[model samples]
Target: MSVAPVLEKCRAEGRAALIGYLPVGFPTVEGSIAAMRVLVDSGVDIIEIGVPYSDPVMDGPVIQDAAVRALAVGVRLSDIFTAAEAVAGAGAGALVMTYWNPVLRYGVERFATDLAAAGGAGLITPDLIPDEAGDWIAAADRHDLDKVFLVAPSSTPERLEAVTAQCRGFVYATAVMGVTGARASVGEAAGALVSRTREHTDLPVCVGLGVSDGDQAAEVGRFADGVIVGSALVRCLTEAATPAEGLTALGVLARDLAAGVGRGRS
Candidate 1:
């Protein structure tokens, strides 16, 4: 019921939980749902569903394309909740990630209410600044939803303290300076970033952005609480000729990444 319990279970098992990201309505609502089911079945610990918006400043080319396709199909906040509900009904936990504009457009209280009813464990508004998050943060708290925030290598001690204080669910530590995608290596900067965040908060720190393979996931798991993979998995789905093929590819990647993180923790 709570993300804390799921995270704790993974920690107790000595396994680094896999958090997979996908933009809602990439191929279509149906295709996204199918992919989500496959990821859950393949042992993903948590799902980060991207709510498509017109302007996605932080997203890279891969996620941006998916969001644009989703919007072209008329994907809205309501549709995102519907998809999340389906995944939750299938016994999977999820976190909805979106920019703040969509949340404001939907009305904070109403959006939070829908998300909670849909069985979402948390919300991640990457563009939500800590100083300006009171309204939605209050709404999320009222609905008992975890409000997750991001911290970067550039965050100062003052900024880290502020983010840590306002953050719940888990802290997302960006592994690179740019948008999301896979890279050849996790890099020393990411390791240093996680270490700095650890000094500011005891909460779980999940490293994301540019993590493409099990080896990278394993490497990140060595320093962070969890590992997040996005573009590589999305690319796999995008290349699939059919939904079934896409699901198959996603499942294989999830399994391999899970196994990689498991080995690292062991």
Candidate 2:
């Protein structure tokens, strides 16, 4: 399904949807694909496939470790698109999240085209500011790819307005001041951040960062249209000895989180 329609469905249900992230080639290309399939089968609404970069500034230790392992296995931008294609071919909606440096290295227009051809629905570059998004946004728009933007608690009202305007698929509402990981509670700060973003745009808001476990997922789900679990999921994959074992663990966790969101809505 298209990004907008999928988000619309989630909103109509009053339950936040699950968006899972896993660094490509974490275990291996094959392992990543298997994990994605399991996630989809476990009822993930959307999948964010991370493109491994040498320097991932926004990622925490878990994701950083995953990226290091992926890079060691020679996972490049091209390999990420290949894995995305495999996921898309399986009838899953996939989004490619990467650093701008890799896209520039691969050529922005070429990367967008390749991503679209691989059935990617959108692109997310956390470090790409709106002021400098002209070329990348234009390229993504040329290929009908949704350009997802991030809004942190640190953003000013004006900056939030600008980000909301540029965002297409959905706005990723970062719940904490630091990198991605699990937290005990989302707290009032996160709720206020979500409320502030809602004042600017009607786009579906998906809360990420510091969300781990079913309870936190449910908490964010109570206030946002979607909940993104990254570091926690990555931790599961990294701890598993085999890809199959990782997939099983992730699928069970996903289902539990999904159940939490469902219960929250009810």
Candidate 3:
């Protein structure tokens, strides 16, 4: 269930992979699953099921709002596995994006066990750095799940090497300096950050933070191996008046982003 294969397939196809993000239990668990299915059907290759956390330091207003709503409705940790199962069922790589605290509270080994059983590809821990990820490393390895870590523009050369060495799936290159949100521009710093990350690891380097539209996806895809989107996709559902309208908006944006990635290399 490693995401490496799907990314490799996209490489073989001469395009960057489109990775979408959605919080489980938003507008209800079933609705979230339907949104994810729409994303996959519209051309997303990998889906990051955001485990609604109380303190999401890396998320922006859009994602934070969605997570708040999800938590308010009592989204349990078990809901993550269910969402992962649905994403896998839809034929997309399913990855859980959660803070380290949740995994530790749920028992790291147990979380990995359930995720793998649910057919999940891996875990993306934003706050857990490689140096502090010993427990997660062992658990993910034991369960055969990929461990995705992040590297920002501020990462020193030594830091990049150390972090990327421990990563199993892909290295996340956080393009923006602040929290996650759709920006007017993905910025000049993102491409350079990705270039720096590539020097340290052979794993696909995916750019996230400040990416929302197809044109931006194309820009990032031109250099990075994948385009990671969250805020904008979440916004489609957050801004919609009804579930059906949200799904419609999600599909249209997903397709646009997919088309954007397709034009990356051309």
Candidate 4:
């Protein structure tokens, strides 16, 4: 259930992997699970099951609103595992993308055990750096879960080396320097960062932050090993008048993004 095989398969096929993100318990836990199914069925390779937090520092307004909605309705840390279980059952390699506090509060050992039991593949900690993540590292290793850490455009060479060294599934390359959101253009910084990070590790470098559509996904797929879309897909669900329409919009976008990934060279 490791995510590495999924990315490797995509690489073997000469295409970039399509990684999608959505906060768990958004719209509703059930709706979020349904959305992930649509994403996978349409074209997502790895699914980032965002564990909604009260304080989501790395997120922009779109994700922040969604997180707030989930929290307002009482989405708990345990509920994240429930959502992860459903997403995994739906046949996607599910990874929990959460801030650090929740893990610390939930107990790293307990979190890892439950996540593994739920059939999740790994974790994506945006606010936690690898150097300060010894406990999580130990727990993840104990459960054979992937450790996916972030390396931003501003990360220095030494910092990039440290982060990517701890990464297992793939390195999360934050393409944009600011908060996460959809943008009209994928930055030149993204390519530069991917090149810089590549100088350190052979792990797949997946670009995230501000990728809004298939065209942008294609643009990023050229240099990145994977393309991650968050705000755009969340917007499809959040802005839709009904849950069914939301799933339909998400599927259409996922199809387009999947095609975008294929447009890239291996």
Candidate 5:
């Protein structure tokens, strides 16, 4: 379930891959799984199955709200695997996005083992840096799971090189210097950051943060290997009046973003 192949396929087709994010157990566990299936059918190449944590420091209000609701309904760590299994079954690479503390609490080796058994693509640990990820790195390697680390606009040349070296599926390039959310623009520094990251590693650099619509996705796609979207997508569900409406909005936005990514090379 390595995401590299999906990104590679998108590259072969002359576009960047669409990486979508949604928290497990949002609205409901089953509802989230069904929504994720809509995303894949609508055109997301990879799905980042969010593990709803008590404290999501990197998340914006939209994602934070969803996480709170998921937690209120008692979403467990195991729910992440269930969602991942469903997403993988739908034919999209499933990667779990979680905080390092939860993984530590769950036991790094056990988390990795369970994720792999669920056919998850890998882990996108926002707060876990390579310098302190010795245990996770070892566990992920043993489980054959991809390790994705995030690099931001403020990252130093040395920092960028160090981070990208530990990454497998793709390097997550944070377009802005804040928490994750959709913005009018993805920021002017994104392209420069991507260029700087490429200086260190040959891995595909996917940009995230502040990308909301198809235009924004296409804009980021022009210089990125993939476009990572989260808050905007989550909002589709949170802002909708009904469950059916939420799914419909999710599908519409996903399809639009997919079309946007495809226009990147054009």
Candidate 6:
């Protein structure tokens, strides 16, 4: 994935990449795929196809509710490959954000191979820190897959160095300490965290969690390489009464956030 080439493109164009997150099989596997196409067409720089996990510890209530609905329908691992293929075709790099246990159960080597064949850019293991990710690291490398690791604001300088050193695409910087959700305003600590993380590596660091609107995207985009929005987009689909409405809302949010990425601090 060349360290997430889509992100590099956005940087060349003079903007922070806009990364959108949607859990696969949300409304339905097909419905989620359709919504993703809308997001890609509307200028989403990257797509995070969330693999629905029973115990999504890092997710907030909105995402947890959506995942529960998907799981109820028996949405399996294969469904994610299908979603990834479709989303990748829409011109946005598709990466799976999943918990460690599911990938472990599916077999790391097999999972990485299948994901590469499905045109996936990589994996984002939210619960699996780099220090304990030896097997995943090897598997991803063998398959030429990008492995994105998360770095929290609380991480020490040494911890940040270790995490960034292992990260392939971009470092997922969790803006807040808690689980993911929309917030009114981004905190000052987020910028400081980005600053602290930059001291460790030159790789792109993307800020996620608690970002909901364009203004907040612009705020984070000013200092980070990318802005990741998840709960807000999921809420859009969850609130929609029909697929048409959902897709429409998704496009609207995508465009708004895309615009925000280019409007970062002067």
How much lDDT does candidate 5 score?
0.94
Candidate 2 has which clashing residue pairs, if any? none
Better of 1 and 3 by TM-score: 3
The regions of model 5 sitting more than 4 angstroms off are none
> What's the lDDT of the predicted structure labeled candidate 3?
0.94
Model 1: CA > 4 A from native: none
Model 4 stretches astray by more than 4 angstroms:
none
lDDT (Cα) of model 6: 0.90
lDDT of each: 0.85, 0.86, 0.94, 0.91, 0.94, 0.90
Q: Enumerate clash totals for all models, in the order shown.
A: 0, 0, 0, 0, 0, 0
RMSD of 3: 0.6
Question: Per-residue error at 205 for model 6, in Å?
Answer: 0.5
Model 1, 45-124: lDDT tens digits are 88888898888899888888878888998776788897888778877678898899988988999998889988988788
lDDT of 5 at 52: 90
Q: How far does residue 69 in candidate 6 sit from its true spot (Å)? A: 0.4
Candidate 3, residues 84-114, lDDT tens digits: the string is: 9999999999999999899999998899999
Worst 10 residues of 5 by lDDT: 179-188
**TM-score of decoy 3:** 0.99
Q: Candidate 2: where are CA atoms >4 Å away?
A: none
Candidate 5 lDDT, tens digit per residue, 1-266?
68889889999999999999999999999999999999999999999999898899999899999999999998888989999999999999999999999899999999999999999999999999999999999998998899999999999999998999999999999999999898887878999999999999999999999999999999999999999999999999999999899999999999999999988889
lDDT of 6 by residue, 1-266 (tens): 54378888888888899999999998999999998888889888788999999999998999999999999978898898999899888888898999999999999999999999999989999999988999999999998999999999899999999999999999999998899999987798788889999999888999999999888988899999999999999999999998789889888988889888889855
The Cα error of candidate 2 at residue 207, in Å, is 0.4
**Each prediction's TM-score versus the true structure:** 0.97, 0.97, 0.99, 0.97, 0.99, 0.98
lDDT of 2 by residue, 1-266 (tens): 24777778878887888888988887888788788888778878888999988899999989999999988988767887787887777666788888889999889999888888888887888999878999988987889998998999998999999999999899988988998777777777788999999999998888899888888888888988888989888888999987778888998898888887877767
